[model samples]
Target: MENIFFPKVVQAVAGENRTVYAYMNDGSIRLVDMKPMIKQGGIFSQLEKDTFFEERLTVLNDTVAWDLTGEHDPTQCIDIDPFTVAECPAVADPLEIVG
Candidate 1:
């Protein structure tokens, strides 16, 4: 079976338990739970600190990412898999608009 994928992520917003990623195609949004990954404690350990985690949410081309170097270095970055994010459940009703 082949996997269907969404368009690349253009923006990401961090929240208490999850991060919302907005895709380029049709403005679709996906909510990814990052708590589990952050608890694993490896490269994600930096996110254990609330301020750092909330402040680090960034977009690295097509994925939700973090800039660990405190500089604009892509090499010292970490990001979630685009496919995984696309497959996760939506943060809210897909048809509803808050604005």
Candidate 2:
């Protein structure tokens, strides 16, 4: 029997150019660019604001999420699927290079 691993985001850091660095439980970091989604408007419109996008960035439901209400309620947050995030190419820790 083979064990299936499900990716879960343990931490998330908002970056310039509307990118998010997702730190996964599998010890991998995935970069998610939210610009495409934000361009689609609707619920994603709120994230268009740079301050709001960075401030609300968080990890919820084990994935990258935005806490719109600042209440930390999973139901009220906008979250990306962990599997979708995991599909992104893995990258080295950006913080390491910056520091």
Candidate 3:
């Protein structure tokens, strides 16, 4: 989780893109998915539709600094692109996104 949730807090720049982390139910922070995206595919399409999160943590005395990510990320676990996530974010996270 240290790598995901416990990272140092950062600010969102108007013209900058950076890594934002999320916390899992396992008391661990999820890892970043640096994989490239698929241009055209059903899974890819879904990722493009989900809402991703942008969150901040309480820096008082927490073990790992993580809270609910702001938006949603459909592609978080699936093998697809961010666009698929942008489509449907409210759906529960699945352990596997494959058929």
Candidate 4:
């Protein structure tokens, strides 16, 4: 039998230029650029508003999400798959880089 690993996102921080830093349970940080998705519009259109992307960014359903309702309702949030987030390239902590 083979063991399957499912990546779990524990925390998320929105970054400049529509990027998100996803902190995984395995202690790895993944950088996800949301510009492309947001540019496509549709459900992502709401995120285009100023500061909304960053303000609503959160961790929901064990993945990176945007709490559109501001009530932390997982059902009302927009979320990215953990596997997809895990596939993104790793980056050094932004705070550490700036410090």
- Each candidate structure's TM-score, on Cα atoms with residue i matched to residue i, is 0.75, 0.93, 0.23, 0.92
Q: Alpha-carbon error at 68 in model 4, in Å?
A: 1.4
Stretch of 10 with least lDDT, candidate 2: 90-99
Colliding residue pairs in candidate 1: none
On lDDT, the candidate that comes out on top is: 2
lDDT of 4: 0.91
Top TM-score hit: 2
Clashes of 3: 23
Give the Cα lDDT of each candidate.
Answer: 0.71, 0.94, 0.28, 0.91
Candidate 4, run of 10 with poorest lDDT: 90-99
Poorest 10 consecutive residues by lDDT, candidate 3: 9-18
Candidates 2 and 4, the one with greater TM-score: 2
The 10 consecutive residues of candidate 1 with the worst lDDT sum are 17-26
Candidate 1 lDDT over residue span 7-86, tens digit each: 67777777555544445444667877787887898998887777777677787757878878768576778888787777
lDDT of 3 by residue, 1-99 (tens): 366422221221111132223233343333333223323544433333323212322221222222233223322233212232222223233343877
In model 4, pairs of residues that clash are none
In model 1, the runs with Cα more than 4 Å from the true position are: 1-6, 21-26, 93-99
* Higher-scoring candidate on TM-score, 1 or 2: 2
